[model samples]
Target: MTRVLALLLLLLALPLAACGNDDGEKETLTVFAAASLTTTFEQLEKQYEDDHPDVDVRLSFAGSSDLVAQITEGAEADVFASADDKNMAKLVEADLAAGDPAEFATNTLVIAVPPGNPAGVKTLADLARDDLQLVLCAPEVPCGNAARTVADGAGLTLEPVSEEQSVTDVLAKVESGEADAGLVYVTDVKGAGDKVEGIELPEAASAVNHYPLVVVEGSDHADLAQEWVDLVLGAEGQQVFADAGFGPPAS
Candidate 1:
């Protein structure tokens, strides 16, 4: 009887261990993304978690150049999403990308000003006004590069008081009233909503930046990383990006 009871206890414990393995276990996927993708990626993270209960998606956002530097310096990232193709190309050139990077979306620069248009920034040319306290992304960043293109196309030479490392940083300066105006992505202006007013510039239309995504070459979670890439390129992910004001990826 004692041996039989012990055997029954062992059988019960086996089921409990199986339950733990099935329900309590999960894997984590680390993603490095551009600062401009913060809001949209956060939403997708939550959605992806809901769909894949056994996987956790962690996101780290910064300027695309900064992200590439981190990855090159041995950061353990499963995926990389760049705001522009230039940074993504850096990874590809280094053979750090697991596969061909796909263009997922496009964005354009817009002038973001404090609420109520306190600086009276009504146009792209207005960013040239010396009296306005302007902020911009540093030239190495995607938004900054796009801003430069827009400025050049419009024949405007801007003298911003501060050059931020990320587009989000530029938006923060405008939102906090530290700067009267900043050039950021149209998606960023939309994300900022009532915190800032967007000034549409026709010149910006000509300088759209393409966003790209790729799985890291050395990632241990290669299958999971590819799934993430598919998720972003799939219809659901495209809808989320579209709702955030991102344009369809170029053919």
Candidate 2:
């Protein structure tokens, strides 16, 4: 009877021990970011995880406008990063931002075409050719907004074969040969390597998009979210952006 009672007590303690293990479970931090930031943010995610063993970083990438819509519609996110200030402004106006947004980087539009330049897209003006299949981001997206700005500044009108929701979608259309040319950010073109060739647009200077980041209001992990914001605005984070072909934040 004594041995049986001792065994029963051990079993009871085992369950308690198992319950205690849950205390070490990592906290999850969800981040919503613009599609243009995919590469850089992925790199940052890995670094952040390495440095913070107790936190799991989750990233959702999409067009800035789409991301704003998601956050405004009550999607739970700890952090938000926008490809342009206009979208970030919407978040602020909606009172979804926990803090003032910080400008982190800048990007400009470029024309991406398949290898060998099959359509001979040499300049922004060339995008106007009716015979060419041009893809661009929807005007509501940051990339699309910048494209329109540059085109209008040049006194030219663009007629795209498709208007995608994200910059990545525009690049994909060009990469898959679905479109002869697409207006994508310079970072996207650089990240594409030999899959596509980029044609520099002189007018792109007039439409540089400023990237911003902010902590979302009512985040369960508000402290962790602020830490992430600090990391991004810190020296190491800026280095990662620079290595990814992103321009420094405007003064």
Candidate 1 C-alpha lDDT tens digits along 1-251:
99999999999899889988976678889999999999889999998889889998999999999999999999999999999989999999999999799999999888898889987888888889889899999899998888888888888898889899999999999999999999899899999879999988778888899999999998999998999999999999999999999999994
Residue-wise lDDT of candidate 2 within 1-251, one digit each (tens)?
99999999999999888777655678999999999899989999998999988899999999999999999999999999999999999999999999799999999988999998999889889999989999999999999999999999999999998999999999999999999999999899999999999999989999999999999999999999999999999999999999989999995
Tell me each candidate's RMSD, in Å, in order: 2.3, 2.1
Candidate whose TM-score is highest:
2
Looking at model 2, the pairs that clash are none
lDDT, model 2, position 102: 94
**Backbone clashes in model 1, listed as residue pairs:** none
Regions more than 4 Å wrong, model 1:
1-24
